[model samples]
Target: MGVLLVGGLMACAPAVSGPSQAALAAPRVALEAGHPERLRLVVMGDQGTGTETQWQVARAMAAVCAAQGCDLGAALGDNFYPAGPREVTSPLFRERFEVPYGPLGIPFIMVPGNHDESWLWGGDGASPRGAEVQVAYSRVNPQWVMPARQYQASVSGLLDLFVVDTAPLAAYLPSVRPQERPGGPWDAAQRAWLAQAVNQSAARWRLVLGHHPLYSNGKHGDAGAYDHLPFTFQRGGAVQALYAVACGQADLLLSGHDHALQLFAPQPDCPGTWTAVSGAAGEVGGERRGRRPAAFEVYGQPGFLWLEITPQTLTLWAYVVGEGGAVTGTEIARLSKGS
Candidate 1:
């Protein structure tokens, strides 16, 4: 079946199966072709299930990027769902990552999510190579670009993105998932690296990327029952890291874990740091709710985020993908830093 994207782009990519009846039942939005911005990038997370919904979203992203000439695609963790792949040669890799996203063509800058680190816990009965296997896979696939668990990259004059390994660090903390015991010796080291990296970056925009959010409206939000009180109970890493980013003059933070589309207004305390949650890419975890903190929030709906940056302004678009794979978008917000 052909799904049309904005700009007359056809979305007839091969899927393991067609989108479910429920997805098709939802309201459909027809997206227009091509964005007006010069530089564009796509961001989304929690999309590694290899389901038809995931394929639909992938096809939408591929079409949008193709129509507008995108520079890169960012996967905000949860790259592989459940326990992650056992090895680079695992069939899960082909079905989940290679097949769905191979059509996009742009390099995917990714981070590891909690599900991606399930292999770290011996009791889970998952392979121990979850994290390393993905990094290894990146060596083979030119499109998958994860150099290290925690590293930073710059797009010359546009931005500098720092991807962090938050799972192991959260596991190291006392209040954060004490039962899981994700003990890795690198928690302190990653924290240190994040601090230094944010402070040292000289790019126009400094974006910190990770799977877990510092603040979210979905299940991980401060008010939610699941992963409750993350900011206070979890180690000082997330808060400290945000502070560092704000201190370094960074305005935007991108993350996924909450499984929703959320845009948080700047905190009264941290005036310049705006957080965007685009986890609604592949799957919806649960309800999204945050009245005071969230500038805009959408739960259960599945979509990805489009960010376009010119020399002076950055505009964000939230593209909603229907069950039939048609994409409709809205201009959610924009930011401008004085030149």
Candidate 2:
């Protein structure tokens, strides 16, 4: 394990209801090269449970941002659970999303997760159009931004974040003959947009975000059932999307679906782009390791990622939250021009 442990925390933002004060005293990790000169982003995924655990992580995020400062906060899809809300004004909106994260006070950039798109898959799914509702929310809430299903957010001079919809990438969609379905055309459009975005981005750092992990080590690892379900470009499946478009261009691809936190370096087959799974913000799930060892893996722990990007270095800190809102283990990774 290349993980490092730290002791002592610089008091987090005012304590919340859950996690005791003692448990919230864990060390707060900071970058060694100092704070980011360009952008600071906090990324979390699969965190829409609206449980105390979710609130705990959100509290930690608020504290960390308050202490270190953050420009934006992003959700790796799955903003809701079971099924999406019935309408833009659905009570679930305020309960699951607004209540917990509203205190952060930063614009939240989001993409729809598989659960958010559950309606598309089956029964009574029409009530809440998770994807559509999120976009509509952006109109009223300044902090919530998911302007389009497939869109890009540029952090000015530093990077471009291409947020994509990956629910359709599941093998099930086309299995039902999508050409005749509503999702068929949209799926094709998404693929085309992804390929073009990766090629056209001229930013110093190009990061692509989707709800599904291109590669993962938890329940949905490379050896998972969807492993061979190829995307438009790759013969095998979703992971190939990164190689097809992000080969020598994109710097990082972030996703959350596995309910675990993982970091994978570029492998021989998929070179140049680094993939990370930050899905443990609210859920603490099991892991199936050794199938494909991640550069770093942390499960049975709910946490989030702090990404500090500068011109010279891109540093990521995987902060694990324990009992209260304290950050326990902080796994750090730094990437530069060349390996």
Best by TM-score: 2
After superposing candidate 1, which stretches have Cα over 4 Å from the reference? 1-38, 120-129, 172-185, 223-226, 229-248
The CA lDDT at 305 in model 2 is 93
Query: RMSD to native for every prediction?
Result: 11.1, 11.5
| Tens digits of per-residue lDDT for model 2, 3-42 | 2111111111211122222331111112111222467789
Error of 2 at 262 (Å): 0.1
CA lDDT of every candidate: 0.64, 0.67
Q: Indicate the TM-score of model 2.
A: 0.79
TM-scores for all predictions: 0.78, 0.79
Q: How accurate is candidate 2 locally (lDDT)?
A: 0.67
Q: Which stretches of candidate 2 lie over 4 Å from their true place?
A: 1-36, 120-128, 171-177, 180-185, 227-239, 329-331
lDDT score for residue 78 of model 2: 80
What would the per-residue lDDT of candidate 1 be over residues 80-103, giving only the tens digit for each residue? 777677678889878888788776
